[model samples]
Target: MLGGEEGIAVSGSAELRCFSAMASLLLRGIGTLVKSLAGLSCGQAPRCSSSSLPSGISSLQFSSTRCFSERPTVRDHPKRPLSAYIRYFMDQHVILHKQHPDLKRTEITRKIGQEWKALPDFVKEPYIVAANAERQKYKEEVKIYEDHLTPLEKKVQKAERQQKLAKRKSSRKRRELINMGKPKRARNAFNIFMSEHFQDASGMKAKEKFKSLFDDWGILESSRKQTYIQLAEDDKIRYENEMKSWEEQMIEIGREDLIRLKQRNKLKKLRPILKGPKVASKKKKTSVSRLKQSRKTAEPNEGRKARSRISRHEE
Candidate 1:
């Protein structure tokens, strides 16, 4: 019985040793996996020790990823100097203005451009030399300006840039949303007629031609107008078909808000029908005037004062 008890104690110690060994192996495996994952992220960064890294990863890499996130601030970026021709124009413009003070800026600009075009190569060489010197000076100044910025300043600039980009994106999104659900107005009969013919309008201005076209269409006979009416009807039908497909596309894209907006605005009120512009005739007043005149004469005469003189003579 003493030997059996000693054997049981030995077995218990062996089982404990096995568990310890398995636990150590698991820890080492986990360490190796972490090191491998870290290596993938680090790229070619210098290996540096950190307390946060897993065991057996003394030579682990820690990348300075913040460098890639920095965007160049436009205010600090290099400025391109004015070209030789522009510098020449500026100098000549001042001198030319002293000689001709009444010249408008626009006229002066046009004149300068023309003169620059007319100048010979040798005449332009001096301005080109001056421009090159200014460009070199600008490059040096820009380098100094960028080198003077602090880390905090750079962070502020980057934040401002991100905000600007976000604002632009949001504005574009709003413009797209504002056109929501409104049907594209189809071209009417007059528009279709203009598009098919009278495209040149005989060199008339657009406004004048538009007025002329409408005036001509107003006088068109019923049969002539019917042709354009048919075209307009067909165009409206096509527009409706296209709008239906567009709504289906919106559904596919899961835009139920746009669909609801479309439904809400779908009901159209009937427009009042109007007749042609011909003036209505006035009612005849000649009969009424004649009756008034006859009554006036009968009262004044009264059978020549009721035929008193003639009847007296007969009696």
Candidate 2:
């Protein structure tokens, strides 16, 4: 009986040991499955510790929350219309931000139907037409102003040029006058003029006598003065004749062109009259036929009266 009881106790101990081992294995398998499910759900590597599981799960939840917060959300609020946004952009940003702000905003907005009635038809139509017409008109106006500016600039340039030219001419004249005042230059010029004009002995003697008389008359620089006077007179006469000839030639050319223009105008006027000559010829023929018919009717009564008188005398 003692041996059987001992056997039964040992069998119970072994069965208890086996059940403990299976229970430990089942717990380990469930823990691994839980870890694998947690890793799969959180998109993270499996952790060894139960303590680490809560923190990892919490981290994944926080990460998901952060990602959701960072994403842009479609709002449930009603949106403003596109036209309103466009109008706001144009008026507030485009118009106000310009360096030179347009004062014609009201007119433009009114034409675009953004603003209420502003200008009358007469005023508005012309402005709209002018704005929408060919840009070439604006270009042409700009060109005209540019052309005007060019002439103005040219006038200023021409004035400056004339002033420079006058200054140069004055400087040249002064230099010539200073050179003429020099004793050596005056002497050379006098010698050249005398050799040319007074080559004969009588003319030379007369010049010498004149010089002596001028010397007696207290004229110290007679020779130079006389040469300069003679040169001035000759230059004056030559310049006058040249100017007169040029003026006459210019006038003659102008008259010829004028006469040609008048003749051209007369011929243009006569052209229509000459083209209708056939109409005039037909009218003349009609008038001549009417005159011949009147003459035949006037002669028939006289011939009848003469016949009647001749018969009475024969009877």
Candidate 3:
């Protein structure tokens, strides 16, 4: 029993020693594997430590490195440039390749050289011609207006000339009329006789004298009957001659009166001595003097009181 116990103790010690060596080998192997995986993840080649790795593991890693290096990358093949692709696309799609039916190649090329060349005769040409004709027509209308205006101007000038001539003639006639005088030559013999005889008579006495003269001459009876019968024929010739002479005298008197009025107006304007209220008062006093003289000649001493009363009543 003592020998068996000692043998069991020696075997247990040997087993423990073998287990420690195996654990140390396993820890070194695990450390080397972690370092290799870290190198691979960082995109680098890992350094091998012969002391850390077994010979079989180093052989396996070398073998795998050949496989990774032999693999293909994107930079190997020859690449076409971007500019070349763009030029190809434009050539295929963008350039005008097809021809239009109306625009011929030769015509377009010629137009490009001579930009101002007339277009092929289209509908616009007729429209332009029509516009030119309308412009010409308007010019013709303006010419016609000018022609008519010339004639109208001539007519207006003629009318103005005729009006001026008429005005001059009327002015000459008015001047001639103004120069003519008053009528003084148409008094009958009986009127003259009465005027002379009745110079100192009253109104009643003058009437009585006229009646006596008609009686003495038989003028109240036969003269009246004969004169009435012959009046229509004789009066016409008599009145014509009388009026002619009277008109001549009136024209002469009117001319003298007009001259006197013109002198009076001129004196009033030019001479301060003539422009007085005393002159007008003197004229009024003279008129009154003439009236008194006429009244004294017409009224006798017996009727003077009555005439004075009548004059006072009139006033």
Candidate 4:
């Protein structure tokens, strides 16, 4: 009887474990379904519809499939490190697209994103591990390539890097020029100190200048920095309060687009636009009083020119 009872208890525990596993899976599936429904309800095409997505949003996925894009797009330049999420989605995108060749690229991407979100950590671990391995491999190869480069190659690489940086700067300058009305970020205590010494540091490269500033800041007594620090804190508070009020006003005014842009910090780059240098169509006129005085002074020269022209013709 004792042995039989122990056997029954073991079987019951096994059943409970099976039930729990099924329950967890069901919940995950339901959650995925709800998300799909929500995406469908929005009635907008998946954002990844285009071959090119916004920077830091999606990868430049080249498929043996359809083509779509919305904005002025450029090829990915100067590859940066990828995160685990990006790696997973990107790899999954190829497989899913190949399987459903007729589905829109954006549609596949939406499905992949949803699936990735639904996956338990354990299931994702293998992909993440593989991604990390690839990253390590890339780093090693890059180091080797750099080490093997000739002087010419090294110079070429440096020029390419500089060109990429210049492109980025030009893009930001354009954005700043266009969005001049965006609020300014408050300067901090360190910023004040830097402003005072900007002339001295102007000649240094960005990294060297920051290093020198750090050394100077380190030597300064805390008490002396306190006043500027307090001012910075106050300025930050003022900015935050103003930003909140501006956001409210934007909503009230029905400028949803501006609200989204502000949340994304896209508007922060805006400043008071400096108008282009005005070319005087005609030479700038002197003030009326100054013009009269100049006319009185120049009357003698005008008469001399007239006399010279008449005399030269006669001669």
Candidate 5:
């Protein structure tokens, strides 16, 4: 009788576990459904028409698929046409690869470049002409595409392009500065404290080390924390002074673009003064005015003397 009761208890626990698992799955499905519904209500798409749905798939399935798909991105314009060199390279690359199957991609490309250089102008002429034609066609297509885009869309696309260009330029400038052995920025009080205590938490995980250090710093006495803050302030002043001299050197070397934006603007405003013709000072102007007055008085006196000499000669 006890064995039978123990078996019944085990079965009951197993059934409860199964029911709990099913309930969790149901809850997950309902949560997903709620998210999909919320996204759909936000007008992610104007409306999912019945005509647009597949014959076999229900509206629900189609909507779910749309919800899971990636959001639409900014670019929809036609890709730019290939250059003449690229056109020739694409045509020859496959042939070269086949001829030298053992060669790596880079080696194949080098061979293609050699062959292209050896080829007569006549062979290259056709590719160049084709590229020019395609370029013209691309320009016309771009014009039509731009005309179709709304003003807001055009602005957004322009902003996105500008952002990409600025990011590329900034990264390039940073690389150039690093290569030039640019001075590092100053650290804050927390960072200074972290560096000092870094070895203490060496055994901890990367994230845990940071958390531990942060907690320690948080509970630190105000007087002790002030010492780190003072060091940070001194380091900051050193960094600013060093950066100022470094930026001046960069400007002298004609690499003004690597300097800070505020400094760059200041340089721009002062450019005319630095590279322009010199202006006469107020002292120089005054000396010139006095010389002119002396000349005027002397000229009148000389005229009077000349008139007296003419009268004496006439008598």
Candidate 6:
């Protein structure tokens, strides 16, 4: 019985040791994961400890793999300097937060704006000076950063920034359109047919179904296809009419920028200013010439009358 008890105690201790080891490994893994996430957020490569890593797996290999896996981001570059207004806003936010604890952030911001506007130029001078100094420093840093960047990296950065700008503009426009209840552009015949018969296509995958629909549309006779074309034309007219009225409403509300270029062009066409100058007809030109000739003949007659009157006076 004594031997059995001793054996049981040894087994329990071994079990406890196994559980503790597992917990430690899990904790180490979580720490590594957190560090990796932080590095990813900062757009930098994460460092791994050699001791934590498994045998034959070095930190160098891990870093190389991670670098290859992740795309470079603008965050990796030096941040741009804050503008004067932003610097002032940041400085005032803390004080304003404490002073107006009951007010919402937006209300506080409004108050800040009013106060900022009311402030004397002398009071704003320090923030302006600091902002200018920081801007100059940022410019120097940018030059240094650019000097280190390869041409390919520069090109990639430019493209990414352009893409980001385009995406932001597109999303903003879309949101505005949605908020304004803008009518959607009409789909063509193919799209109409696809919407009508997409689910009926004999394909499990979307791509396959799309291809099948496309193939069927191509083979469709002109008579049947004409029906879809007619529908598309009607939808186009509906979209145009709705868009025109919507744009007019928007113009009334002082949101002309929401109107499409095509719609603006249509509006311009409606104005008399855009029309070409009217040409006089041949008959009208002849009538004008005759009036000019009559005026010339009348002028001579009037001169003769004046001369006769002067001769009579002399007599």
Tens digit of per-residue lDDT, candidate 4, span 1-315: 459889999999999999999999999999997686555522243445444677765665443222332333233333546777888888888888788889997888789888989999998998788778878877887777667676756776678779999999999866853474445679999998887876687446877887788788889898989977998999899888877776667656666455546564644443223433444523354466678899998999999999999999999
Per-residue alpha-carbon lDDT of candidate 1 for residues 47-110, written as tens digits (9 for 90 to 100): 4566767778856665544433355444555668999988988899999999999999999999
Model 2 stretches with alpha carbons more than 4 Å out: 1-258, 261-269, 273-281
Query: Per-residue lDDT for 61-93 in model 2, tens only?
Result: 234333323433222322223333244336445
Candidate 2 weakest ten by summed lDDT: 73-82
Q: Which stretches of candidate 6 lie over 4 Å from their true place?
A: 1-75, 171-244, 250-257, 260-315
Give the Å shift of residue 1 in candidate 3.
12
In model 3, the worst 10-residue window by lDDT is 72-81
Question: What does the lDDT read for residue 128 in candidate 6?
Answer: 93
Candidate 5 TM-score, true structure as reference: 0.43
**Candidate scoring better on lDDT of 3 and 6:** 6
Q: Please, what are the lDDT tens digits per residue for candidate 5 over residues 1-315?
A: 469889999999999999999999999999998886666643454655767777665453334436555643455889999988899899888887788788899988887788888999998999999999999999999999888887767888988899999999999988988998678999999999999998887446879899888889989999999999999999999999999999989988988878899999997889888876545676789999999999999999999999999999999
In candidate 4, which residue pairs clash?
180-271
lDDT of 5: 0.86
Candidate RMSDs in order = 36.6, 45.7, 64.0, 27.5, 13.5, 18.3
Residue 161 local lDDT, model 4: 79
Q: Give the count of colliding residue pairs in each prediction.
A: 0, 0, 13, 1, 0, 0
- Model 3: how far is 132 from its true place, Å? 61
lDDT of 3 by residue, 230-275 (tens): 6445545676675556544644555433333554466447656656
Give Cα distance to truth, residue 66, candidate 3, Å: 5.9
Residues 174-249 of candidate 6: C-alpha lDDT, one tens digit per residue: 9979988999899999999999999899799999999999899989999999999999999999998998799889
Candidate 5 worst ten-residue window by lDDT: 58-67
Off by over 4 Å in 1: 1-80, 158-315
